[model samples]
Target: MTTTLITGANKGLGRETARRLIAAGHTVYVGSRDPEKGRRTAEELGARHVLVDVTDEDSVAAAAATIAAAHDGVLDVLVNNAGIEGRTADNGIVAPADETVDTLRPLFETNVFGTLRVTHAFLPLLNRSAAPVIVNVASGLASMALITDPEAPAGFYPGIAYPASKTAVNMLTVQYAKAFPNIRVNSVEPGFTKTDLNGNSGVQTVEEGAEIIVRMALLGPDGPTGGFFDAQGPVPW
Candidate 1:
């Protein structure tokens, strides 16, 4: 059975992804910054727990070490799901660019850079698997094409910080795919779903949000890599 580790797995989309993977019979590891929360969530989901703060180098290293030992250096999937929505600036596009930059910086610390940290640390373990897959939990708001479309009412038209961070994640995903052709690396937009990040304003459910992620995680070796997709299909970058 493939072993999958999902960062920020304590709640929201991360928690749902872990639950789904466990139900599929894969050994799932729930990675959270808080041990209590991670352990409890894992216990509830019938999976393992790993304390991982993607923003902290030491924490990320320790998490890799723990997982490597348990899985005997073989990790099939690494889900870069830890991210922040960043604070909102009420003023739409005319909002202070600094506000967006400041808010986005912290999110990137976990979303973009954190992804690199975990991927680099766990690559050896992933390489040991027959089919290694890396799924970056990006969003449709990350798409510059969609965000810049004046004709369409896209989700990207709103938050500057969150969308920009996710865009960076998409680019990072592309780079990872290039760097490791053996590993399938792709970014997926989970669409707007009811979750804590949006205060549950989304029209879709968490199960719907997790569908694309779980699908990407389970892709075969011949599956497309370095692509951006949603539940329905490919999303323009």
Candidate 2:
């Protein structure tokens, strides 16, 4: 059976993606930091639960061991969906001028470094699969082409850390795809989906946001790799 793991699968887009993949006959592992929430979500979606805190190395390693033990050391797909927006409670974006190392650190910790940590820990298991796949959940704001275009709405966004971290994720996606020629590694833009990450202010639904993620996670051997895509099609880098 195809086995998959999705980080931050307790709610929002992650949870939705887990549900869809499970329905598609994948043995999905719902990765979450909270054991109770993770177990509950997994039960509701008929998936398994793996406790993981992407920002913590020990936690990520333990989670990897758990999945490997459960699935005979083989993981077909991995969805790095854990992330944070670092927006203030009032939903204020830190201006570029006000951006400091301290201000930017939190976002990078989870969105960038955390992604690397989880992917690194799971590489061995993923490598053992006949058709390994890795999906990095990215953002439209991470697109240099879109954010730099004067006519694009993303160009008007003022946040510095979240966009910068996701841009780093896109880079990671490219490098990983190049490094692992056999694995289909790619980044995806979920569009502006209504989720806690955006304070429910996004324009689309979680179902819509998870479309590209599910599509990429299900890629076959001939599918495209090292690309940034959304539900509509390819997103500019």
Best by TM-score: 2
Number of clashes in model 1? 0
Clashes of each: 0, 0
| TM per prediction | 0.93, 0.99
Q: Lowest lDDT 10-mer window, candidate 1? A: 87-96
Which stretches of model 2 miss by more than 4 angstroms? none
Candidate 1 residue-wise lDDT, 1-237, digit = tens: 989999999998999999999988889999999999999999999999999999999999999999988888889999999887654454233234456455668878888899889989999999999999999999888888887897755743655667777888898899889989999999999988888776667788989999999999998899999999999999999
The CA lDDT of each predicted structure is: 0.88, 0.96
Q: Cα deviation of 103 in candidate 1 (Å)?
A: 2.6
Residue 206 of candidate 2: its Cα lDDT? 95
